[model samples]
Target: MNRSAEMADLSGTIEVARVVLVIGLVFLHYFAYPNSRVPPFEGFDPNHHQVATFVNSFVLFFFFSAVPLLSTISGWLFFGFSARPWEAIRRRIGKRGWSLFVPLVIWNLGALAIAFALRAVAPTSSLLGPFGIDFAHFGLWDGVDAVLGLTRLPVAFQFWFVRDLFVTVLASPLLWLMLRHAPLLAAAALCVAWLADFTFFGLFIRTDVLFFFYLGALARLRGVEPRVGWNTTKLLLLVYVVLMALRALAPLAFDPSQPDQREMLDLFTRLARPLGVVACWGLCLRLAATAWGEVIGRYGGFAFFLHAAHFPLIIFVKFVLWRLVPAETDAWMIAHYAAS
Candidate 1:
């Protein structure tokens, strides 16, 4: 096929894959992520009530789907990662982005300022009064915290992704060199490291994550336009499904009676996550090469932002609506109205 035809085909397939992924993600969050949609502990042990859990899951299925759609549009309008200050800084600083002195100085000041501000206005609110004014407690301050943590410092939950991204970016130079000399070996190393990451290391061991992105870049650099047939796509999809199944089963492999087996299963699941991510990503890329690729790519690009921002927006809207409206009506309805 000619270059334009190839590009269009890839774009279409990517779009379709992205749509499927978004749907699947919402499904997982609603049914799989219990803590997210379910009510917080009404009592001490936080026991899940059968009725509440059932209602929460039913409502969340629709709610999670809407967030991704909204977040995808927002990120596309805002300039992808252009909202990230450190991403800009990295472009300017290049490899020296990791140099501790100047970057650390800047980050510390930012954190301190946030801490002070959180403390200052915190007393008015029950939540913040005890924590003292800090980025950890404040809504506006958390985004800044995410940015600063992207500089490879650990600040909080969102910072983990940022830090992982940074670690990947910083190691790109060495990865580039390795790719030139030994592409096969480089890919193998990445797979192993990815497995290691699941079982042993924290997210900061970014070499594995960077490996796949670099692999994609290298394929482009090498003029490789993979023409994956339907059979191949099917095979990949099957493998992905099995991997996901195994991941779910991994935790259950151990009987509650067998702690040793449980630990092993837990370890296995950890390695399986990155592997599953790769398998899923591969299926996504293959599907993206088809007609619906463009749509998928657009939505997939905003997955991170939408994933993070939507929770807060959903929470805030739910809270406000609950206060204003009677409990007799649906909380999800109010959340939906506010979200819209």
Candidate 2:
């Protein structure tokens, strides 16, 4: 194939991978509702409940890589196409402001407005939490906190990715320059930052965004591409199995509340996510050589729309379920999972 055709094939493969990743994210969000802890499913048969818990844990273990993979792909595309760094950064910021920032603000406002309406209509419903616009309790500072993602009241919790993406894109030019000039040092600095945040502050700084974004830029600079053959694919599959095992055993190995344990898990996650991304990318690249891959690529852009709109739909479904079934009940949980 010609150079243009090759690039087009790569783009299509990435898009197909993105679509699959987003679907996995939807499933992750669905199953991870209430909390990351697997529910006991009380009153059910012990064997069946144990099986369900194990399945849930297994699924969530691998699903953790989706966001990192998305971030890396975004970085790759952003830097790969840019001829002039500053001009590209300026263009990207403007585009993302309209496409990302504006949507985030609108969504947050819309969610708050809907919550207020719900509270007004059904005063007894347990829907509204800190999101309710009670001037007496919720002040301007609280609104600021909500907008900044310190509080998940006004904004959909899923939009944290949007916020992080905006920040990463805004800083992409500088990161790109650093990677070009002193790649190793830049990577080391990012790793230190990530470690500090994960160890000390519990990831309040969101260095995962920076780490994966820069990793993508570095991959582009190094001309990295997926070249998985049968043997390599089998090796990667083994790596994936080992990663899943570690993820499943995490809770049993250490208390999540411990800083050291949290740090260890975070480090393990950093390793596992990129490995998963590579494995998924290789598979997508192989698929992209087929006819159906083109069809999948055509619909891949819908993933962004799905990400933006699914949270509201989830909330609506949960509200309907809440009205029908008691909270914390097995029926309500099942309905929420299905709706998601």
Candidate 3:
């Protein structure tokens, strides 16, 4: 293929992968928010519940790659292809300010308003109570606290991703410099930094974002591509399966509540997440020219729109489902997933 064709193919592959990753993220949220009555096997026997949790958590591990993959793709496309890094940064800031930052602020305020209204109208309703705020008890300080993410209550639960992405973009110039000067050394340093106990500016900077972004930049600088064949893809799959099985299943069989085991599992998952990103990318590349790829690429932009709007939609759907069902039944779960 010609250079332009090759680049388009790669872009299509990444877009398809992104669509899949976002769908996985939706599933992760569906299972994570038990209060939303969306978890498929929630409220079962203790053993059954643990098993279900394990399975859900395992699925989540595969999709944890979603954010990293996004950062990597962004870095690759933004810094990798840029002729002038500083000019690119200025353009990125303007674009992202309008696209990401404005939406974030607007959505969070909207979510807060919705929650406040729900709390006011349905103070005693179970369906609305979880999402509602205690307006009667809510002080100005409480409002500020929620805005700052200091409490369990969030203005918008998924805004963290936007916040982190904003931070990463703001730092991209420095990152691009590092990647350009010494790609391998930069990647190695990032990986080590990812494994370390650290925070930036008193907030926990997502090291995975930095790591994967630099990884992508380094890949572009080094002219790397997803060149895995079936055999290599199978090997990656096997490794992922084994590690996830140990991470997920072992906890169910043992005392998952133990601090040490939980810590160990967290560490294991951190190591496995990047491998999962690579495996998923390889799979996407392998299928990028297939009929399915066209469909995925067609909806890739919609995935971002969905991510932005889905949380409020979920809450609204839950309210509607509660009114229709009036009971916590399997139908609620079915309807919730369908809406999601």
- Candidate 2 — what's its lDDT? 0.67
> Predicted candidate 1: what Cα RMSD to the true structure?
9.4
lDDT, candidate 3, 1-340, per-residue tens: 8889888898898888778877877766654434432232222123433444545656666677788888778767766554776787789878888877777777777778877666678766554544435666888877764553444434676666776666677777787778768767877877887776344543433567767877877777777865567678778978987777666565445454577765666677788888887777778887777998888888878877777677766756655654565544445545444464
With candidate 3 superimposed using the best TM-score fit, by how many Å does residue 298's alpha carbon deviate from the native?
0.5
Candidate 2 C-alpha error for residue 291, in Å:
4.2
Model 1 agreement with the true structure over 228-333: per-residue lDDT tens digits: 4556657755665554444333323334236676566445544544434434445656656555565566676565444333332333344454455444334543
Q: Which scores better on lDDT, 1 or 3? A: 3
Model 3: how far is 44 from its true place, Å?
11
- Report lDDT per candidate: 0.43, 0.67, 0.67
**Model 3 steric clash pairs:** none
Regions of model 3 farther than 4 Å from truth: 32-46, 49-54, 124-154, 315-340
Clash number by candidate, in order: 22, 0, 0
Where is the poorest 10-residue window by lDDT in model 3? Answer: 37-46
lDDT of 2 by residue, 1-340 (tens): 8889888777888889878788777666554445224432111122333333444555566767788778888777777664677787788778978887787777776765676577779766645543445534767776665565654433565677877777677777778679879998988888787655542243233666678778887888788864566567667867896777656656655555577776777677666766787777677777777898888888888988777666656656655655555565445555556654
- Greater lDDT among 1 and 2 belongs to 2
TM-score of each: 0.52, 0.81, 0.82
